[model samples]
Target: MNFYLDVDRTIITKEHREALELNDFLKYLFNTGEVYWLTTHCRYEDTSSVLSYIMPFLTLENYDLIKNIFPTTWNTLKTEAINFSQPFYWFDDYLLEVEKRILLENRCLEKWIKIDLDKNGNNIMRAAKSHNPNLFSSI
Candidate 1:
C-alpha cells in the first residue's frame, strides 16, 4: 500500500513536540509500503522546505529514511495528488471538507487516518507497536 504522510500535528504533536515513536512508525511504513509527502510544506514537488522543517525532530537515521519519501504536488486539494487506483492510506491531523468529499466519492474515506495528537498523545507509539496493517484500528 502507498502511505501518504502529513506533518504538523500528525507526526509532530499539537504540543509542538515530535511523537516519541515517530522513527519506529516511519520505519514500519517505509518497510511495509511506499511513503510520500502529502503536506503543504512539500507542494510544487519540492521537499527541501519540508525536510528542513522536520529535521530537528528526527534522528540521523530517520532523517535519512525520510529522504526516501517521494514528493507530491497538488494544485488545489491534497487529494489531487493521490492515485485513487491504488491501495493507500493518508495520515493527517485535519482534512478539508472538499478533500473528504473526494475520498468519499472514491470509496476510500476509511483510508484517511485522522491523527489528533491533542486527544491521543500516544497515537504514533500505538501504531508503531501494533505491527498490524490496520495500525490505527485500536486507537
Candidate 2:
C-alpha cells in the first residue's frame, strides 16, 4: 500500500509536543511488508538534501528509496501513474483542490484520509477505521 503523509506534524515531532500512540501504529505499519512513504514536502532535491535530518525518525536509508515524494503540483500529474486497484492512504494538513480531483477519479474503494493541520493523531486512524477495515487491525 502507498502511505502518503505530511512531514512536519505526521511522523517526526518533538516528544513534548507529540502524541505517544503514533509509534504503535507506525511500528505496525513498518512491520507489514510493502509500505511506501510519500511526501509532498519540499522540492525533490531540496528534501533529499536534508536526508540526515530526516533519517533519525525515519529509515530512509537513501534519498532514492523514497518513492513518490513530489511537489503539490504533481498531484495533478499522477492520475495515470498509480494503479487505481491498489490501496492508498494520503495524509496532508491542507488538501488541495487538485488532490480532491484526483481522489474523485480513483476507484470507489480507495480512500484519501484528510488529516487535520494540527496532527490530532488518530483522526486519520479513525477515518480509516470507518472505511478501510484492513488498516484497523494495524492501527
Q: Largest TM-score belongs to which candidate?
A: 1
Could you say which candidate leads in lDDT?
1
Specify the poorest-scoring 10-residue window by lDDT in model 1.
Answer: 127-136
For candidate 1, report its TM-score: 0.87
TM-score of each: 0.87, 0.55
Residue 113 in model 1: lDDT:
80
Q: Count the backbone clashes (under 3 Å) in each candidate.
A: 0, 0
Residue 17 CA displacement from its true place in model 2, Å: 5.3
lDDT of each residue in 84-117, candidate 1, tens digit only: 9999988887899999999999999988887766
The alpha-carbon deviation from the true structure for residue 120 of candidate 2, after best TM-score superposition, in angstroms, is 3.0
lDDT of each: 0.82, 0.47
